[model samples]
Target: MKRIILIGRAECGKTTLTQALRGHKLQYHKTQAVNRHDVVIDTPGEYAENRELARALILYSYEADVIALMLSATEDYSLFSPNIAAGATRPVIGIVTQIDQENARPDRAEAWLRLAGCKMVFHVSAFTGDGIEELLTYLDASSAADENV
Candidate 1:
């Protein structure tokens, strides 16, 4: 599997999505540091929220096959700047979480992600198992493609 690194603000569902992707029961767990899994790296929200720690994400991206920038559909604004992923050496994908929330605005989130330079964007709800399969399938295909190269 390709190792995907997830970056996002607090409560953006990186951990929840990680668990869901691994086929584990959903659990609430605070990620204080970089949580490295077999195929995922869950970073604390601070790494993306605080400018001082933002460089760490760029550094960590070196270890990942793909860099995923996540945003909650409920967020009214984007923490990521336009073209933020332009500097990444690896493929950058966007993940819009919390799409099941009543106040979710997935379209706005997707637009922000596109502005942030993601090559592809996915809207997913870890709680409802929505869009997870497609994301996983993409990951699998990406990993296989990488191996062929």
Candidate 2:
């Protein structure tokens, strides 16, 4: 059992992604809070209260081998990154969520990352189960690839 923490902005599907891994929504609560960091961020992404949550996530990353920093593909990816990293310097994966919507601009998101010089970006849709497996595989490989944790 890996101590992996999924950190992301509000409504970025952090809970939803955990559900997928749990096999279903009902199975989500069956697992211990080990998989989640117990967030208390206020409504709206990156609220002032999120700083506390981000700090917890920061501490959790010390114990976490992999931190999935999720972002909205509809917006710029660079905004929520590095900050969520919280000095872990660990193997962090960038997840761009909510790409299944008709207004979702995955290409624009990818292009924006490229323009910002970020090559380690993964585009995924939690609703349609797209690229979710790849994110998990990346998380698993990150654990084996690094011994720092």
Candidate 3:
């Protein structure tokens, strides 16, 4: 089992994405870090929270083959890795949520990721079930490729 840490802006469906992956509602907490038995952990994006979470995630990413970065369509700054398609050591993918919003543009987001240097970026809407499966497909394939490599 791999450990996937979900980090993104508040109200960016981090909880929803975890639930969808686990097929149940995700439990939130104050002191918890990694969820057990293949459970994905969720954390608040507070500066202190992120500073702490980032360390744990960096370590976890060392063991896991992938780091799924969540990005908010409604949140302009809800991104990581300073503009890249994939990150070092592990394959990274951009999860675009809130696609139902009026300003959520996948094309623009794709361009941003591409410009940022991300080799692969996928879009998803946790509410409408729009791009979840597609993202899953990409993640699975990328992870498989990563494993094979």
lDDT of every predicted structure (CA atoms): 0.92, 0.55, 0.59
RMSD of each: 2.3, 5.6, 3.9
Candidate 1: C-alpha lDDT: 0.92
**Colliding pairs, model 1:** none
lDDT tens digits, residue span 11-42, model 3: 66677777666556545434343543364656
TM-score of each: 0.94, 0.65, 0.70
Model 2 stretches with alpha carbons more than 4 Å out? 26-49, 76-78, 81-86, 110-119, 142-149
Model 1 segments more than 4 A misplaced: 142-149
User: Compared to the true structure, candidate 2 yields what TM-score?
Assistant: 0.65
Q: Which residue pairs clash in candidate 2?
A: none
Q: Write the per-residue lDDT of candidate 2 for residues 15-128, one digit (tens) a residue.
A: 666666545652222222334432211122343126664455555567665555556676644455334334456655556777887778877666554443344678877678
| Residue 125 displacement (Å), model 2 | 1.4
lDDT score, residue 3, model 3?
52
In lDDT terms, how accurate is model 2? 0.55
TM-score-wise, the better of 1 and 2 is 1
